[model samples]
Target: MGRLSTHILDTSNGRPAKGVRIELFALEGDKRHPVATEMTNADGRTDAPLMTGATFRTGTFELLFHVGEYFRSFGAPLSDPPFLDVVPIRFSIAEPDGHYHVPLLVSPWSYSTYRGS
Candidate 1:
């Protein structure tokens, strides 16, 4: 069975981005329906997959990561309007039965992500 999961790595600190807020939404037309909200664990991963098996759908979805506050908590010097604040990752589950591991490697000024296992 396949599932959807994500994790965050603070590239600046070289550690897991623990305690960062994350929100998941299902996008339809011009509306975004809330699906799930979770915080990164000590290991930088959510306690559970965002979606799994019977509940996983194939379509557009979005993951919003609140990164500015996270960096501020660590006292990173950033502009009033941080370069990277609400990092939004939009993707599609072309194959719902295939595991989708979307991991984010981020810093105050940059971020990257890719599909994994």
Candidate 2:
């Protein structure tokens, strides 16, 4: 399971998105503040889990993915106004003590994310 950490995969290229910038935010009273920032490794995972054991909290959170730039860097051709631009995946951490795996399988035109192992 993802546990306190998580991973993402680019299905378009069949590899991890190394160096991709990832930002995590906590949604609070209409104000979103940066909670953490990291880059995906060669395995499309962060060097450390987004949430550590001591501070895993239950609340609404957001992940901003620079998909357009990521695809372009990989040399993936896109149409004149690419279908998918910056993608924002939002979810809730219902249980802080449990592991959470949110994996993204993405492409230029489409994408999918779910609670993963």
TM-score winner: 1
Worst 10 residues of 2 by lDDT: 1-10
Top lDDT: which candidate number? 1
State the lDDT of candidate 1 residue by residue for 1-117, as single tens digits: 778999999999999999999999999999999999999999999999999978788999999999998999879989999999999999998886889999999999999999987
Give lDDT per model, in order: 0.93, 0.79
Q: What tens-digit string does per-residue lDDT give for candidate 2 at 3-110?
A: 456677878778887767778898987999898888888898999888866667888889887777777776789986778867889998887567877777788888
**lDDT (Cα, 0-100) at 93 in candidate 1:** 88
Worst 10 residues of 1 by lDDT: 93-102
* C-alpha TM-score for every candidate: 0.96, 0.88
Off by over 4 Å in 1: none
- Please identify model 2 stretches exceeding 4 Å from their true place: 1-3
Q: Name the lDDT value of residue 104 in candidate 2.
A: 73
